[model samples]
Target: MNLADTIAAVATPPGDGAVAMVRVSGRRARAIAAATFRPSAGKPLQPRRFTHGFVVDAATGTVVDEVVAAWLPAPRTYTREPTLEVTCHGGRAATAAVLQAILRAGARLAEPGEFTLRAFLNGRIDLAQAEAVRDAVSAPSADAVAMAVAQANGSLSRVIREVRDPLADLGARLEGSLDFADDGVPELDRGTARAVLEAAATRVDALLATAGPGRVRRHGLRVVLAGMTNAGKSTLFNALLGSDRAITSDEAGTTRDAIEEILPVGAAAIVLVDTAGWRPPGEMPVGEAERLSGARTDASIPLADVVVHVVDGTAPHHATAGRERIAALAPGGAMLEVWTRADLHRGLHAGNQVAPGDQFRVSAITGEGIQALRSSLHARAVAGSRGAGSDSGGELLTNARHVDALRRAREAIDRAMAVVAGAMPDDLLAADLRAAVAACSEVTGEMIGDDVLERVFRTFCIGK
Candidate 1:
């Protein structure tokens, strides 16, 4: 973790592949590479351009592996420090040998996220950008990747800094008024201060609105299928996923555990879960497995972002009770009613007893209404994102820490607005504005604490 030491690590993921890379960063990166690597053409290694080379054991001068090395000098590299990357033939022996040779040449193994921490320390990137690197690497869906890329490109940092700028300016003006009392500088009136603070609060509100959808898109929405035994939850799950992911059977209580799958609905991803059939504890003539299955189904309801309560269209009332139970346990506005076996319905409107407008009627057997249901799910997922009401295309705040920081900034601005409205002293308004600026700075890492930085970078994988 020492900032001054040269660090090296295998940048590519573990295991055999077409190629692998070893990354080295710090002041001694170039020197270590020069010691362990020899150019194929017997020419001196140049900066920024790749050179075909052989990685050699420093102690014995034995060629370890064939590699292509690139040396990048400080102030323009990723860490704003001297960096070297060696791409070698993919395999455990070759890559590991090359890395060992680099280590023997005076480079220490890098700690988790050390490269990115160095980038942040050297001012090549800020806190938000550092976080974005992790997000981009671990993104589970396309939407998540897009959001991460935007933040990595400084979208979030720019937004935070820009919002803080006006507040900082207001604080400077208030200080000027206080210091130049005898010079007759016009002091900021409560009305003007309130107006400025309110405008800033509105911007914060806009950013905060993206937190929910950002989280949903980042981690994906948990959509669980729950209903009475033999209600076709497994069938519906398989139908939605377009594969036989879950075991479907005609017998009741066949599904004994929750089967989870990642299903992309438009740009958003849904963590679709198929839970065991719901049954009253005493009503089921079952063993320990069935009891546990019921308990799991019950437990999954509350955690789901959207619970698709499936009921048999042939016996809609039988599922009504289960639907009500799930709705009670699920988060508000998170339940979607689905009536299965729509193909078997024979009565008016295909034996659809429930009101036609409120629920989605689907038939797993015939694939009827499946695509419509997917489209509806996709639309609902999109609505959960920040730009639901407009085409603003603003950056969504995906990080929980960033959202919390924005909330704090918004609260500070609110306090300043309230103080101004109360005709409080200009110094009090300035203090609140300063607090707001500090909160915003946390997002950009301007005034961040050591503990926060440690926690942020620790989540990153080693060799990042």
Candidate 2:
């Protein structure tokens, strides 16, 4: 935690690879590098350029590993401190030995996310950008990667500032009017102040609107396939995934547990879950295995964002009962009714049945209506992530912390607008505006506390 002390850590992942990196930062970084590394050309280390060298023990002069090292001077480095990076042949022992030599020469191991924390503390990047770095590193899909990269480049920060700056200027005006009223300074105009407050609130609302899609993009949509036994759930699951991940059979209760796979659809991913078929308990004498399978299906159905209720195309009588069961299980989730074995249905009577939601007739064996179902799933995924009022294509409020902060800011702004409408004192108006500004500052890390910093950075891996 001490900024004056030098820190070092293995920056690469712990595994065997072609190469690994050890990073050092602080005033003593260059000194530690010099003590442990000897340049192959026998020259002093130069700034910003990689030099071939050998890392050795200072006491025994025994070689540890051959490396390519770089020295970066203060004021231009990631932490705005003198920095050193060494690339060595990769393996657990070689990477550990290089880091150990640096530690022996005088460098403490960095705490989790300490490197990015230093970058924030040194004014190289804001708090939002720091969080974005973690998101980019751990993104699950290509779309997620692009979104995280945009956020790290300050897309969200720019949006916050755009909404915050005008309110700040208005607050300053209010303060000036209160402090210098006797010196003939102009009093604030209530109408203009109200307009500004309203505009700022609108912008904050727009940001909040993105939170739903942002969450869906960050964590994929959960879509569960539920149906009666032998209703072709496993076959359709394989057809959707384009692979035989689930065991399909004519036997009832073949799937005893939920099987899950991820299907990428446009800018979002669908977590497709195939649950065990449900059978009414009293209709047939049930065994313990059948009870467990039904329990798992019940558990998975309620948690899904979309529950696909599969019905056998040949059995027209079971459709009403299936719909009732699905409604009872997933009352709040979106429902899609699918009739399997379209190839076997010779007439339109079964397919024309009235359904509450979307209905699709699909034949997993013949590939009939599969593409249409896939398209529907993709549309639902994209609709959930749409950036409603935002002009920035992919910029969204993905983190819950960010959404909460913005909500607080919007509430504060709403209070300020009410104070203006009531013709309240300038001091009261200024206080609310200041509160709004502080809330926005918290998002960018300009006015955050140590506890919040610890919570945010602790999620990051060490040497970040």
Candidate 3:
């Protein structure tokens, strides 16, 4: 927490704009800026003041750029250290010059996520709030921004505290019960402990449920469209995107690669991908066109969070020998059987079984069942998040790490619960409870070490 090294970075997004921000944070932040900063007005780097200045090099003293430096002196700033943010002319060269001058004046380049990490270490924010800062910065939509802002302001930290507080108290009491057992007094009643554990477990479950929705707000959904070429796949893509992104042609196999676009589906943007149509298994794929198309289609299938299998309404199901093929190649995903070109098959329709084991529908042209399809898609992607919708009806694990930790925790807790029920001894119950607590701690990084932090941050881009 005693960081003498000042960290600086261009905080604004990299681009040409009217203005950009260069941020500096740490104990020596003001001094580092003073080395290169030539302020023209206001109380000079005082406790609180914004000064107009021409940032310059310390040695030769050449001007870098005109900037507004506002000082938020020690312990009362982000990172709980003295901080200075310079608003400079927006451009690659001007922004770079200001930051370079700060660096030349002795500020170290901040590592990706270092500023937030420093904030965490200095107690200005918790891990969750620190993470919320990143989410808030990278928010794509207004809703996500609002949610991230709420979280950064400590909504999730409060919820986490509400759930984690009792557990911590229970843990302390349990430890006390063991330590002072011979004193003839119990710190926590057995029944009360059971009730408290159950309540904590229930709260964890609710939080786990909300995690999906939270991630959805952070990352948009993935919706992929697949079927035989000329099944009106491009038309459907055009309809959803409200633009002609993919070329429409009557020729079969017109599309040979995956085409993805963001479509506004309710409050969230769903990434819709139109893949190369599913081809017959051994159709003597004679050229690069055939091979690449098939490969891309196969690759796209596994990548889909949800699949919309387009079935040509005008074609006989058995003629192309594909109804069974499409069913067999269901891609292990949330699928919707779509009967495309429904306008051409109104009277002749005999209620198709296009998606034998999934929901089937009709239309690409003439808008024959698009609304129903929209509703189905909406049901699949809840509020702009990735993965499956809410009704997937299973405690579907969200984070792979959480899933692994909770699986271990569940087993440990179950063992402890059994032992507490007198099915096993108290000593065994206590040990199992400790193990469960350790497992739960993993999810919150309580049991994590420096190596894990290194691994986590290494995956992040620098200057985060």
Candidate 4:
């Protein structure tokens, strides 16, 4: 946390790779680099240029590792401070040795997200952009990466500023009218103020509308496959994933736990969960492990964004029981009925009561209707993502924190609208406007507390 002391950390991921980065930033970044690194050409490190060097231990002067180091001067670097980055040969030992040498040269180890926190503190990027950096690095799909990249590039920040600026201006005008009443300053027009508030609310609502899809993009959609015992759930799961992730068997309750895998469907990712088949207690004598497995399946059902009720196509009784169980569970989200072993039974049985469009028949063994089933699941995934609205191909409000802040801002604006409609005192109206502006400012970190910053940045990986 001390800005005066240089900080160093391995910026790259752990384990072996082609290269690893050791980053040092602060007032003494250049000095630490000079002390720990010896340029191969007998020249000092140059600004904005990479130099071939050998990292040396400060105390013993032993060669730690050969590296290519870059010196970035203050005011233009990521932290707007003097920064030195040494790209050493990849591997835990080499990266660790390089970082240790830098620490030995007087640089302290950087905390989790301290590097990006420095960037935010130095005004290089706002809080939203800082969060976006984390999202971009961990985005699960290509679409998610695009959304995060756009936000990191300040798309969401621009929208927040657009909403905040006018509200702040209106609040200032209201304050001026109240304070300078006897000084002949013009009184603020209620209609103009109302118009501004309404416009700001509309913009915030648009951004809020993106929250559902934003969440879907940021965290893959949760899809659970549930059904009666021996209903072919695992086989269908493997078919959908194109891998044998879940074990299959003819014996009931073979899977005693929830098995999960990430399956990318089209542009979206699905967190596919295959759970133990459901059966009423006492209908079949079950052991403690089977009881726990059923409980786990019950637990996973409610959390799913989409629940695929897998039924045995050859068993008419299974279709009826599956429907009843699904109704009892009431997943409270999108639902699909998939009839497995379609190769054995070519069509829907008499027990299937679901509409034609909502049900699918597939055979995991013969691959019959497998692609069609995948397409149907993909369609459902896409539908879940579009619940808020159609993606306009712009920035999305992916972070829950940003969504909560916008919701609060929208509520304040609604209150401000009410104040205007009631012709309330300018002071009351200004109070609400100020609250709305502050809420928006919180999104951009223009008016945020240290606790929130700590909570936000602490989620980042060390050396980010």
Candidate 5:
């Protein structure tokens, strides 16, 4: 965790490519590379300059490989260290060769996420921005990338700090109201307290409201396929994913657990889940899988960025509008409706249109209307979290951990507001306010725990 020691790693991903990169940080980074590199143009790489060189093994002083070297001087680089980046031919052997050279030159091999970890360990960034570094790399979609870039550049951190500072100050003011009341110092007026509390509460509540959507944006959108038995949900799922990821059959409960595929969506990706269509609780001992599948679909429904209701329009009308499935799946929400096997019969397609929002007629058998359906699916995936809260124009909190903390803080604040408005003493109000401040502090790493830190960093990809 010490930031002083230099760290080095192959930053680019493994496998064949035009170029792979090895990144090094800390004071000795440049010096170590200088000894192992000889630029064709001149003396070892000039500061803030990139040059062509051949990596020479320090042990034997023999040229091992050709590389393009870039050196970024201290205080002018990521991690605020003397940084060196070497671009070598990309192959499994090339990456290993270059990385081994760097390690042999005295730079320590980096652990997963250690580069960004060092950036945080040093004063180059805060916890929020450090976390954003991973998001930028692991971006699932363009919208997620945009939000991550904003946070990495400090937009999100600024908002969180602005929110945190006032909450911390309010906690002190409440404590002061209790401590200085005995000293005859004028306590915080009821009007002033309410104004501050309400404003802070509103700011937090606004961020919390977007938490659900923001999470969906970062994590690929989840689109669940639901319909009655043998309704061709699996067929559409396979077609959309461009693979036979789901098991399709004429049997009623063939798809027991929900099957999922990661499909590349517009500017991002989405997980299309094909679930067992609702069937009466098992009578022929066949309903166990069906019941479990329905229960899981119901559980995942609330988290869905969109729900695609697929049905075999040719099948007999079981319930008008499939109300039970809609009620069980979406409840008080809206989802896309699609009629599969639209080419089966003319009369079948007639009663298929769900109307209102978006309804599509497609045939998994023939390549009919699939392109349009894909476009619709793309729109839903892209619109995500921002679809509902189009008006709020500030940075949003996307971390579920942060959201849970904020929700707890808001509850404590609400309790304090009630306490101040009624029978409780100012001292009691101070305790609640302190609890709220502690919860908010955890988000900013102000007064957090090591376990929480490990959990956050553990989610990051290796060599971040």
Candidate 6:
């Protein structure tokens, strides 16, 4: 919380990799680097230049780790402060050594998101953009990354300012009319006030409409695979993943639990769950194990964005049972009928009687219809993410905090509009507009409190 003290942290993720970096920010950042870093090239640390160095202990004069250190001076850095980044060999020991040297040189360890928080406080980026940085780091798919990048680039903030500036103007007009009555200033008429507030509301509604798709983009879809036992669900799951993640056997009740993994289909990431096969609790030969698996599969049905009902194409009886099970288990989720083992269907008719679409047949052994099934899943996932009225150029509200603030802002604006329409007093209408302005300010960090800021930045990882 103390901006005056220099803070240091490992910028790269903790683990072994090709490279790791330690970041330091504050007035003393460059000085701390100078004390701990001895340039291998025998030169002093230069601004905005990477210098090869060996991090040395200040007191013992012992070499710590070989590194490349850079000094970014104040007013041009991420925090708009003197910042130092030390690139060392990737591993916990190397990063720790550099960080410890920084601490010995008087830089304290940074908390989670402290770097980004400093950027926000220093006016380099607003709060919405700060959240976008977090979103980009955790984005599961390319579409999510795109939305996050747009927000980080100030798309959402631009939209907020577009709406908030007009309301601020409306408030200023009301205040000026009230304060400058003797100066012959014109009052803001009810008609003009209503128009301005209504326009702002329309813009807010436009942003709010994207919250659904934005949420879906931020958090990928959950797709569950459900069907009766020995329906070749595991084989199909393995085929989709292109790896033998699930254990496939000739046994009927081998998969007694849900195996979950992420399958990136085009721009959408699907959290695919391969649940245990369905069976009546009392009828299951394996008793409790099968019963528990069935329960888990049923529980996952409601949580899925898309529930795929997989049935053996060779067995016509499974079609009816699969349909009944999907309808009874997952009433609200989108359902897809996938008939497996098409290569072994030796019957006269090739298509399923219940669902006779080309999209319904899939043979795990022969790899038939697998690509089509994947495409269908991708299409459905895209539809779930792209809400009504969503366009490529339009900005999206990806952060929940922003959405909540915008909703509150819209509610306040609605109240202000109603107040203006009722021929209310100028000060009363101004009060509602002020409330709306405050709510809007929270989204952009203009009028947010410390508590909200703490909650927002806490979701970020250390070193941002």
Best-fitting candidate, measured by lDDT? 2
Q: Summarize candidate 4's per-residue lDDT along 50-156 as a digit string, tens digits.
A: 99989999888999999999999998998888999999999999999999999989889998999999999999999999999999888777777777888888988
Model 5 residue pairs with clashes: 141-268
Models, CA RMSD each = 3.0, 3.6, 4.5, 2.3, 3.5, 3.1
Candidate 6 residue-wise lDDT at 234: 90
Taking the tens digit of each residue's C-alpha lDDT, what string does model 5 give over 1-464? 55667778888888999999889888798788878888887776778778998888888888877999998887878877789989888988988888888889888887778777777666687777878888888877787888889888887667666666776787787677677888887777767667777877887788888876687678777888877777788888888888888888988888878777778876766878888777633323254666687677667666666777776777646434454567565676657777788778453333433554477778887878788888877776666656355233456677787788889888988987887688577777778878888877777666767787777788776667
**What TM-score would you give candidate 4 relative to the actual structure?**
0.93
Over 4 Å off, model 5: 1-4, 174-184, 228-230, 242-259, 262-269, 276-303, 317-326, 347-358, 387-392
Worst 10 residues of 4 by lDDT: 386-395
TM-scores of the candidates are 0.89, 0.84, 0.82, 0.93, 0.86, 0.89
lDDT of each: 0.84, 0.87, 0.68, 0.86, 0.76, 0.84
Backbone clashes counted, model 6: 0
lDDT of 5 at 339: 76
Q: Supply candidate 5's per-residue lDDT for 312.
A: 73
* Top-scoring candidate (TM-score): 4
Q: Can you write out model 3's per-residue Cα lDDT over 14-76, one digit (the tens) per residue?
A: 889999988888877867777888887644765677788889888888888998888887787
**Which stretch of 10 consecutive residues in model 1 shows the poorest summed lDDT?**
346-355
Better of 1 and 5 by TM-score: 1
lDDT of 1 by residue, 1-464 (tens): 68899999998898999999999999898788879989999997899899998999988999999999998988798888899999998898888998999999999999889999999998889999999999999886788889888889898888787788988988999989988978999887666777778778877888888777788878778788999888888999999999998888988889998989988876778888999997633466378999898888889988887788787778755765775687577636467778889889853222233345446888987898788878877776666654543322377878899989889999999889888888878888888888999999999898998999999988999889
Residue 41 CA error for candidate 1 (Å)?
1.7
How good is model 5 by TM-score? Answer: 0.86
lDDT value for model 1: 0.84
